[model samples]
Target: MKIFNVFPETIFSIGPVHITDTVITTWLVMIAIITISYFATRKLSVKPSFFQEIIEAVFEAIEVTIKDILPVEPWLVIPVLGTLWILIGFSNLAGLIPGLKTPTADLNTTFAFALISFSMTHVIGIATQGLKGYLMHYKEPTWLLLPFHLIAEVTRTIALAVRLFGNMLSGDMITIILLGIVGLLVPVPFSLLHIIIALIQAYIFGVLTLVFIAGGIRTKS
Candidate 1:
């Protein structure tokens, strides 16, 4: 293992685009999600299996998170938010696998997520409130705040990306260092803690996305 390798190792090159280990891991995670989802819901009956119950509980939790942020139709946004949670949660937990790196530890993945949320915020804003009303949100309270609002929008997205990258990278690095120092078994507690933190970070990312979208949809009264 390459100890303390901050950058993702390039596995191969397709044309000019280099495919990294992180990308490979992300693809595996997506496939796993799809497989699990298909199997879990494939035999859905009125009497839910334990696995199906767990899946439903997760969806319920995500729905509650969305409803907490916006009173709007939570079902309409569940697919987006639910996918975000699954992707992020899986990415964050990838560190548990010996050879797999967490995609969330890479800026490319987090920034992509942030960019999607940023686009969704404005898109939903324009759809819910007319384009004119959506644009007017920047000038809420006073037009003087337009520049600040615009700057905040871009900066916050960057912040969101960096926040996930930094946290996941730091957590993984620490776990690796501890394991190296005292061996793997000694770091088991830290690994558990990392799992908790990873889930929390995923939840935060999803909630922030929902909140940003909600803000965009609500125009000045």
Candidate 2:
């Protein structure tokens, strides 16, 4: 029997471009993040509000995570990784709302994220170690390993996309099936568990991105 269709349905079109609910939800998520950030930072002062304290804690946590991973100061990479962690976590949890969908459940959305991480990994690598230095890492130990290194990069990016897509897709399907059988109240525990898993996946995705980039920055290993 068919469960959920992996592809999202087209909601509308503009000119020649067709937009899916996935895209719309993603835009909504982006707007929400931007609005919250604007409000959170606009009132900066000597003393922090309660909401500002929570926001500061989130940023501190991201910095600490990056510090634990990359030996560098964590300044350059913080913005990209922190955005990924925040946006992806909120996108995943969007499913908890009654009318909204989780944008990360869509393969296109996750694939786009993986590509961003992949591209930024190389960009930051080059910025840290210059182009020639970054490229030379592929030939480390011997030139014979370069091809294997290339293949690993491509495969890992694909795996990164597929992993998030599979987990969120399966979670959505499970919740739908349970809702069909047991109605609303019974699925509450599972729903909360799903939320926790979503946050975990978001953090894992950011950490994996850092790990991939860390290798590029340091050629020795």
Candidate 3:
């Protein structure tokens, strides 16, 4: 599956821990999100700054999505969904920076994100419906379907990871091939299309996470 080293490489290691370019890029993404959010919200004024306005709009959008998706209290998922949207968007677009590869293009990174979504869905499910209640949810119609339900959850998570990873990796490969074959000018449109795809993928990933979370919370057979 390795093509032109489009996959992430171990840039360095500390003691027994090996660090890949994906790790470095993800670190930068997290730091950037935190720093921007902190500074933007630090000074609360009647008339907010551009960053503040943008931040508020982002939060509002996620909040609305949560409200629309969930029947009960939707406050709990807002932060998680917002973070996912912003982080994936950042990671997918990170390739735009010279010398830095997009972390989302790495299967390891995407799988980690998918695992987080899987974990959170169950955690939130249990939170919404106590431990015993959530566990018993699988036995809705009958105990016979428990295994099927569990398998579905796992398969969907894998699909989510692969979907994002495949798209980002293909986009990067195409961009690199174009650049190698025809310098930079021709790839501009493709790069722009890549950006649009990045945003769309981010939106799809976030919405899918929210939908999965909602499914866990709703408690159906």
Which residue segments of model 1 deviate by more than 4 Å?
1-4
Q: How does each model score on lDDT?
A: 0.86, 0.87, 0.84
**Reference-based TM-score of each model:** 0.95, 0.94, 0.91
Model 2 poorest 10 in a row by lDDT: 1-10
By summed lDDT, the worst window of 10 consecutive residues in model 3 runs over 1-10
> Which digits, one per residue and each the tens of the lDDT, describe model 3 over residues 1-221?
12337657888999999999889989998898899888887897889888778878878888888799875578777767678889999999988887778899989999999998898788888888888877877886789999999999999999999999999998989888778788867777897898999999998998888788787667743
Candidate with best TM-score: 1
What ranking emerges by lDDT with the best candidate at the front?
2, 1, 3
In candidate 3 the C-alpha lDDT for residue 48 amounts to 88
- Candidate 3: TM-score? 0.91
Query: Which whole-number lDDT from 0 to 100 does residue 139 have in model 2?
Result: 84
Would you list the rank order by TM-score, best first?
A: 1, 2, 3
Error of 2 at 29 (Å): 0.5
> Number of clashing pairs, model 2?
0
Q: Write the per-residue lDDT of candidate 2 for residues 93-114, one digit (tens) a residue.
A: 8777776677888999999999
| Model 1 Cα lDDT, one tens digit per residue, 1-221 | 22436787899999999999889999999999999998888899899988889988998888887888875687767888789888999999987887788898889999999998888788777777778888988888889988899999999999999999999999988887887788867677888898999999998988888888888777645
